[model samples]
Target: MSFPQLLTPEEKLAQGKTALGIRDVVVLCGSMRFAADMAEVAIQESVAGALVLKPDCNMKIAHPLWADPVEAEALKVRLDDQHKQKIRLADRVIVVGDYIGDSTRGEIAYARELGKPIRFTDPEVDPGEPGGDPAAEETAR
Candidate 1:
């Protein structure tokens, strides 16, 4: 018979928080172009007593670490998957930007699919909100 696998570090952390009754876990999702703005929101979330998780790097900026084309593409894929994992670990998701690109839009859809509560820094861009444009949701779907 197959038994359960060990919890990952992220899972362990989440379990620990739940055991400790620390429920405010927020994940930030948006384009890397608004990385700075997301950082500010992270600070605000932290101050508001949330355990905030966000993009650790802005890969759009030129960097020696991701200088190679193949490496950079692979890293981008890895980072996107990691962010999805963060979303899974989070209790809530926050989209932090005025513009909603394909990636961010996909994140929003995924959050919605998972039944996680989502808030937008720019409410106008929230596709689920009134007057949020059906076109965007169509494109996202």
Candidate 2:
């Protein structure tokens, strides 16, 4: 089953380097702590697949947590600046977070503030939509 279009992720990012002249994409996820790595991988893979499908663009994975930090304060500042830089530099930002509370809300808000589209993943729910019908006998048409 498919989700309501509006509820589905925003449309794909289109930036054909040869034609559209846009070259790079930077993806930022809410947290790459543990299992979240899979979601981040999926996010990168999708954009990479798009580039491969068209062969007109290049996508770069921007995992901010990998940034080096000399100290706690420096880490904070670096993260803050890197976040904004990704928004400014990339053609778009993809944020992958679970269906729980707004785990990616801050990223989404940041992207929105920069007028960028935000994408999400529902790990618990099926890919396209929710689970099987709970009321299976209501109207078995």
Candidate 3:
């Protein structure tokens, strides 16, 4: 049996459709510690036809002032605000890990406050399936 080939994000967006037909914008929220995982999820979502947005994890090294704790914290707050704005522009928010860190939790709460739907990538859940705890799905909406 021949299986269908998956399309790249560019191809998917070019087609203007997805398996779920949810081609709206999505904001990916996760800890900087899981930057790679966040990027993977962003790519997957983008391929699945969502316009995915993620923080620039490379900003720390690009800005030398962020090496200082005070400066880093201030920059973090500014970045977090920018992410919240992205969430405001998104149709939904996808948290990228099984464990929610402090920052991720804050982003989730902010997304909830703005009435955006939330989804999570839980290891216990099948990756091939629409994932996230049902309780969280209910609460996010």
Identify the candidate with maximal TM-score.
Answer: 1
Alpha-carbon runs more than 4 Å astray in model 3: 1-23, 58-65, 123-141
Worst 10 residues of 2 by lDDT: 51-60
lDDT of each residue in 21-127, candidate 2, tens digit only: 54555455454432345454545656665321111111123345534434544655565566665565455554444532343455545565565544444433212
The candidates, ranked best first by TM-score, are 1, 3, 2
**Cα lDDT tens digits for candidate 1, 2-102:** 99999987679778988999888899999999998999999998998899999897898999989999999999999989999989888888888899998
RMSD of each: 6.6, 13.0, 12.0
- How should the candidates be ordered by lDDT, best one leading? 1, 3, 2
The best candidate by lDDT is: 1
Pairs clashing in candidate 2? Answer: none
Count of clashing residue pairs in every prediction = 0, 0, 0
Better of 2 and 3 by lDDT: 3
- Give the TM-score (vs. native) of candidate 2: 0.45
- lDDT value, residue 9 of candidate 3: 56
User: For every model shown, what is its TM-score relative to the native structure?
Assistant: 0.78, 0.45, 0.66
